[model samples]
Target: MAYEGKGVWCVGEVRHGDLSPSLFELITAGRIIADARSETLTAVLIGKGVAAKADEVAARGADKILVLEHDALDQLVDEAHTGALTAAAGTEKPRTLLFSASVYGRSVAPRVAVALGGAVASDASALTVTDGKLTLERSAFGSAVISTVAVNAADGPEVVTTAPMAFERSGTSETKAEVTQAAVDPASWTQNTEFVSFSADESKEIDLGGAEKIVSGGRGLGNADNFSLIRDLAKSLGAAVGASRAVVDSGWIPYKHQVGLTGRQVRPRLYVACGISGQIQHLAGMKSSDVIVAINTDADCPMMKLATYSVKGDLTQIIPAIVSEIDKVRGSSNGS
Candidate 1:
């Protein structure tokens, strides 16, 4: 397939004046695809006063950086951001454009694709350049199945939004990319949407999407009150609390903590499942975790089979003991 664009591009995201951590992961994935196609890995950074952070993106893996700056971009107005990104894409004409599968990315990427008359794939878990064709792997049917799709290169540039924790974050490099400032006229673009005040989630705990360690509860937890055990264990380990779909559907916990195909997909370093039967939907969200520990009474549960460590017991008793042991370990370390 003959490609229309010159190189691979990653759309960088910023939060609180810092580059989004997901940018590095996208860069890491982009590097592989760029190298395979013998093209440069470029990144588009858009935000007011973000020029200073251009080096950060370069250190990760970008071979070049396009910095789009404007006071309007300081706060994320979807129309302004999408317009700027669309302009950058028009100028760069990249063969493949990557966006993080985040709330910001999901809202912006599709609009950019529409403006460029290009194809887009959302929630892509894997990417590859096969025989010069860009093939993306995404979860479908509630993550019970993996679907491999090849984009039509002849159409135009291919835009894709990658799932969270889909790829490892790229390491830093001594080499810095050449940064260029893109000219964008915010006034020229028609924006019906206005930027309003932003309010964050009320929960102070770690969000499930980016947590390194997660302690999750399931239907086997018996009732909503038993979630205390999950929280206690999470607090002891300094981990986030997560929940299976059944638990959330049953109103034992809020949907924010739910982890499954229908909920948030997480790839934590360590995932501890208490009383989870390991339904297929649940496994789809967390099977990518580095280590899985399952505590369940049933030994034949799917989660037990997939877990790196399996403990057979009652979670009410098991979780408290684990939390106690963790506290003792922490206390001893602190005392020393």
Candidate 2:
């Protein structure tokens, strides 16, 4: 649609005292769209004390930065965030808005859209400006089907939230963006929610989304006690531990370790699947991994077929042998 307003706006997110990893991803995606639409790219940061973070967004490639801060916005209470975003949109008059597909983005996009009388595209994996229209590709039916939708300029301002890891994060740029302090009065907005406190995930493992390497186990591990094999291998490889849905539901592992359509989506440089059958749901979450290694006795399994390297064997023996080999390699390097 004709943003006839000004630039493409990227709504960035801050979580746990720092900018979320997805913020740079938004900038990378938003820059391309802004260029295609012949508009500037602006990053919007709304949070108390977020004004000091504008430089980070600028370093990531935003041509301009808009900061909206208030005591009420110290955390992402929907009422304050939605109100601040809507107010920013009015001031910026951007033709398009992009947000990270996090808890923050998914919640705020629709509310902001309704407030602006605009159409919203949620959890879109890709964004493109074509033939004077904005198009978004989104996954549907538990990620079994991909559907595309386009919005014309006349349909009102475009609002969108991007799926995580859909676009690669941008590297730091040499250019700096001009920061604009956008005015927002959160006191006037209706307050229906309160942020009591931030609870951190107690899991000691590296977060699946950001892990460089992952070793995921499945039901073939036999019992919860046997999961030690998986843990040993993961420890040797210095990788995060993940599990298929079956093991997670069987009480062999916690829900946080589950990796599937219903669980967290991960993109790691190397993903090792032990005993996993590579069901469609599981594949949806990890097929994007740079390299996949599957170990299973059933050579005909889907995981084996999709794996970059397949090992057909007993998991107990295979995992121990792998770990021992790793120890040998490290020991040799240490000259002990």
User: Top model by TM-score, which number?
Assistant: 1
Looking at candidate 2, the ten consecutive residues that score lowest on lDDT are 1-10
The TM-score values for the models, in the order shown, are: 0.90, 0.89
Off by over 4 Å in 2: 1-3, 153-155, 210-212, 235-238, 324-336
Model 2 clash number = 3
For all candidates in order, the CA lDDT equals 0.87, 0.84
Q: Residues 224-321, candidate 2, lDDT per residue (tens digit)?
A: 88899988988998899999999999999889888889998777889999999988999988887889999999999999998999999999999999
* Whole-model alpha-carbon lDDT for candidate 2: 0.84
Q: Per-residue lDDT tens digits of candidate 1, residues 85-182?
A: 88877777898889998888889888888888889998888888877778889987766689999888565688899988888898888888899998
Q: Which candidate gets the maximum lDDT versus the true structure?
A: 1
